[model samples]
Target: MAETNSSDTRILMFPWFAFGHMTPFLHLANKLARKGYRITFAAPRKAINQLEPLNLFPDFISFHPVTVPSVTGLPPGAETASDIPISLSRFLATAIDLTIDQLKSLIKSISPKLIIFDTAHWIPQVAKPLGIKTMCFKVVSASSIALVLVPARNIPTDRPVTVEDLASPPPGYPSSSVVLRGKELQTLLFVTNPFGDGLTFHERITMSMKNSDVLAMRTCHEVEGNLCDYIGSQYQKRILLTGPVLPEESKSTLEERWGNWLARFEPGSVVFCAFGSQIILEKTQFRELVLGFELTGLPFLMAVKPPAGTTTIEEALPEGFEERVKGRGVVWGGWVQQPLMLAHPSVGCFVNHCGFGSMWESLMSDCQIVLAPHLGDQILNTKLLADELEVAVEVKREENGWIPKENLSEAIKLVMDKDSEVGKLLKENHNKWREIINPKLVNEYVDKFVQSLHEVVG
Candidate 1:
């Protein structure tokens, strides 16, 4: 392999076909592009259009549209995970796998020095022969990676891994606080089931970590140092950290309507709630969540998708719910500028699903954090925040995984109440972390990350 120039190296980013994954990859790409490295980001054509507006350094970064092959059982025109339900993600993975030849063609034409990817474990096989360095840049938390995906689990076993097997932490796992129990263990089923042509979701991620030339995560050593070290030891590979890789400050202000409405409340009084794009609550669960907000008797702005089987949020709302909360709350079934909302002076608390992106957003903001995690990684993230870090509170869940409205309301008040000792402690801890993860620290991590890429390429 020939040595590559540090100043002009072209990097290809091929994240898994999910907005959650793509958005983080773009945040890192923007960081790299700002440093003058050229980036070619590949995604489906429609996804490219959606991501175009977020391309901060378009002059240095370009979008490459890859055609997703038609696959049976996958919805027509569904190129990303968000378009279909979680059960059909395996078919989407199959669709992504079928694009290997297409990606190889792009690789040969671009001849980039390094390619960063997640979930597409085959990248190293294709890139090694072509003399390009491959990186498995995980967008998920390192705690989740260390807990489940490590090699000690002995994946590809003769029998499928049972929920019981996942209940306990793997050998030499870094933390005991991140364990899954009760109904949470059921979330690990996808790890054992086939996600792509011949591999399970666990295999996909482990293989990516095993085969890549470099391993990186969108986390910092300050928060997850021990977990990162554990992964490095298990994989016997170099590990790099990117300190949360938060999006640059937007020049555009919040949408005028949201801005004006939020201004109606006193400073640090309104509760802001939003789940990421992937979580669609059931009607019962949706009603419980909004009623929880109502029980708080505080102004709130909630942005979430409608319940399953319901076309609009209004149709799924509880009887007389909207009329009662009309002046004080709104349940919007659309996208909102979450970062801007958190930045709003009137917003005092954030109730979120604890997606990796949302995790960092909540941590960076001044709002009181309340977590309600839905997925496997998300649950682990909630543990990291609510249990390990002691910087947030998680809503208590029943044995069946249902969160009661009273529990949700109590969790919020624990952080929002003026006289609550738990709220004051959490606020103090969160402020300490926020100060540590400032811009200077993030820039340092990105600098070292770029240097590591050059070293790997050479």
Candidate 2:
């Protein structure tokens, strides 16, 4: 709780309005503040409120809330990306763009030597004229970044791009070809023209990349060395590796509701499943997933919201499903303490959406993983884990990319059965990664980042 010295460097942070984006930014902010840097963290009111309870270093870190300008079609008072459907994301991006002037005013008032902004393409333009440096802080995996940034064949404007176009790699791009399939691939079409915003998602990303003075990712080279190298070489930018910028270990007590449920299971006997704040599966998809859990014959805890247009988890669940698995399964409706759940001794494997945050937490927890990636960045993240890291296995998918209950069940059983070859490898890799992604390793990266900051701004 000690105050920063008068000579402490001031840093301004602006993260895209999503829980996934904000969480990592908060982690970096706290890490920098603990090192005696004065930090100003900015986001919408909702995101700021979410960050309040997690702000461990309040003495040196301050929160600044920016009003998101309302755009037509965006739900009124929807401040972050989680509040709306994925199709409305570009509208959210446009809404964030409306706050450039307000952000510019904040920059002028604080006069920070450097600004760290995530996916906000407008920041570099505003910061340049004021002689302040800007860093584009990407919170997703480096492979995701590389995959998106890699040049691809242009689709003809006459028709919508198909899954085939996306599945194929960009000709002559550096990394091995990894592309989206099924619902994830279908979402790519909408992303191409989100809300008729003119600029595609890739275009916005490119703008942010070109405008920033440096690129900072929330992953270390040990986990993603090739992707990191490819990104830097492709962009010709100085990339700062932040060593997975993982959440600090939770020492706080768990809420009574979840704590009581977890105590019943034997050590390493439960499967912990969560798909993040934004995912909403279809009734069929949800049913298949539940059936997969049922087939495993393992006690499981799942945290998921009702799928879109549904009022409750009951509405989406198959009839008699709850009663059939009453004693062995728990379906939590809303948010729970994720880090605590993953760390629990009873949890054996994480069946997740394979978002970078969940992936890192799973790796750090020594739990094997079953990946069921949902959307953007997730497909690529799945490839990195299942294909590159060999610590996780992707759910089986049909030729058309639909995941059947049998395949999902097989994937789960494969990871949980430690006697099996794949399962043993997963546990071993998970343990090895836990050592590599230790707190000391992250601290070293932060130190390097700090040193580089002095060199860049001095």
Candidate 3:
């Protein structure tokens, strides 16, 4: 790396192929681009479709596409960002084998001073031998990271991770609203993780992180300083506290879109329900959720997946449910915009799975929460979001750990009750957070992160 000013560092960032992973990095990328650092953002073509538009508008940022290979265990036609299940082990091996040569070519062209990449357990080998300086961009919060570090023996591997385990505070970090789930547990406990040449992968990721020069976390200091500090100490890495990188939604447009949702509602009149893109509620469970939303009599908007072979929302829904809530409730198989929905004034509360992006947007909207976390460290996120954060309520679960219809209805009512003591506080705190998490301030941090990279590499 040649010595240069902070303005000179060129960075190559590889984000995980999921929405949660890409969102924050994009925020940082935008920030860095604004700071005059050159950024070559690389990922499987599909994984970064949302960012390509920005690249065209700014000379500082460029998209570098990599082809992810076909893995035998992955669903046919699986792209890097596809939510379909692929054998993690096989997926990592196959994809890395195909992309390594391509990545080297990209590196030769750009000669990035630093490579800040996603912290997947299966992705270290490509960077290790190239003498590329790598930083671990942990897309999840530190508290969630701590929960993921919990030992395998502590989890009940027989079923879904529960709110019960997440409620308990783990040692070595301050508590968070989120808890660890089977997904994070599974990733951590993998006996044959794929990051290394042919060995188990989790151990490799742990080792890589411990030796990393920098650790960029998707967290704001207000709620997670202690946890972040502990993480920094353990890993011997410098901490960079970057707030949640929200999707690129304009606030005025958000305000306008939300204003429309509000026109149909009275003050504090509606509930907003959505699971992140990765979730697919089983048929029976999904219907129960829709019915429960109906039972509330609250005008709502839900983002649901279209049923197989269906093109419209009406076909996927139960009879009369759509008509009864017609105009009052709107259902979309998928909406291109979500941040606008949360920021809408009529949206008084949210029922969500606690994915980092959804959780951050809900909080930023000043709405109350109804937690329904699934997979990975989300069990932890759900627990903290509802139980400890005092800003949300946890949806009740059955003995089997699923969120049942009766409980979902009851939980919604509890959070929306006019006289419920918790409702007001939750809303108040959420507003305070939104104020602190202004997009402008977050954008500055993003710029500084990139600028610093340039200085270091220059």
Candidate 4:
């Protein structure tokens, strides 16, 4: 390793080619760049373009765009893991692995002091032999990482990890209880399988951690301190906490169309519902969610991505459903400014998919949570909040883990109905947790992380 002054220190970031992973990497890049370290951030060109709206990176940050290599059976222009259906995501992983030589060439050209790569699993090995220091940046929560760190023997090497295997508490789990169900467990297994190319996601993450010099997580001691400590002790590696890596708030306001619409509702009277970008609800599921919203008789705003291969939410809505709920509901398509939405006074409860980004963002606000976990670590995250932390309420799901239509209204009522006992508890817990999650505390952790990075490279 070479010693360099802070002004000359350069770090390259290569997160998994998805917004959920890329956004946090970008946030950290901005933070590091702001602190006077030169940054060279790299990812698929499409993924880089996605950051344009946020203007997250300073001019000091350099962008290195990697052309996504083609994969057989993958749709043209689907460069990201989120662009295609879940089954085809593995192809994107395969394509990314094929870019190792290109990445190596970039490393040679820029000669960064360190390379920060997220979850790709193959990046660290590529950088190591070239004499570059590497750090694995986990964008997910510590609990999610802890879940994957479960010993391999428990995952059944002879076969794919079963639902039951996942539901049982992994050895050394902080709790004695199971955290995932059959359906959510299945999604976790499916998403982690290196895009279903060969190695399980957990195996790749374990190997990546083993290969990297250090691990940088997007969380802090005030939130998941125990899990972070457990991971460091179990893995025998240094962990640098990035304290949520929350980007600076956007200066622009929400688009006028929805902005004016939301103003009609009283403060704390509207439900703001959104799942993260990758979740494409099935039409049947979308209809049920809408019906649930209607049953609550509450003013609501929903933003949904049409399912893959489809163009609009109208195609998924039940017949005459839009007209029926016209005055009380507004369903918009495609992405919106999420932070602004959460900050709105009219928004009281966030009905979310429990993505770690969403979870932390919601916690940072006054909004209470109504969790409907859709995939991967979301199950564990939901459990940590609703079951263990008691700050949020889980929508009741059927035995197989599907949220029935009825559970939707019931879950919302439990969180939003002020007079209800569960609702009062949920709000109380939200307020208590929010105090602990203040910006000042998180920034202190960020300062420590920057100091640690300086120690590593100075």
Number of the predicted model whose lDDT against the real structure is largest: 1
* lDDT of candidate 1 over 1-458, digit per residue (tens): 11233267799999999999999999898888877789999999999998998899787889999999999989999998888878889999999999999999999899999999999889999999888889999999998899888898765478767787787778888788888778887886657878888888888999999999989999999999999999999999989998898988888899999999999999999999998988889899999999999999889999999989999999999999999998899999998999999999999999999999999999999999999998888999999999988999999988888889999999988899999999999999999999999889988999899787768877
User: Which of the two, 2 or 4, has more TM-score?
Assistant: 4
Error of 3 at 443 (Å): 5.4
Q: Tens digit of lDDT per residue, candidate 4, span 381-427?
A: 88778876688887887877667778999889888888889888877
| Global local distance difference test of model 2 | 0.81
Clashing residue pairs in all predictions, respectively, total 0, 0, 19, 2
Using lDDT as the measure, what is the rank order of every candidate, best first?
1, 2, 4, 3
Judge candidate 4 at residue 434 and give its lDDT: 84
**Model 2 lDDT per residue over 68-126, tens place:** 88898899999998998877888898898888888889988999998998778878889
- Candidate-wise lDDT, in order: 0.90, 0.81, 0.66, 0.79
Which lDDT tens digits does candidate 3 get at residues 1-458?
Answer: 21233364578877766666766676677666655667888877776676565442256677887777776665665655445633443464455556667777887888776787764443345555666667778776566666544232144545655555544545655554344444344433442334435534444445556655667778777667777787776666677766776655553355455467667787667888888766766666777788888888888878767643555667668887777887787776764456766666677778888887777777777677888876555665666566666677778667566667788888888879878777777777767767777877777766566555644455
Supply the TM-score for candidate 2.
0.93
Least accurate 10 contiguous residues by lDDT in model 3: 187-196
Worst 10 residues of 1 by lDDT: 1-10
lDDT of 2 at 316: 83
For each candidate in turn, the TM-score is: 0.97, 0.93, 0.83, 0.94
Q: State, as a TM-score between 0 and 1, how close model 4 is to the true structure.
A: 0.94
Candidate 1 clashing pairs, residues 3+ apart or interchain? none
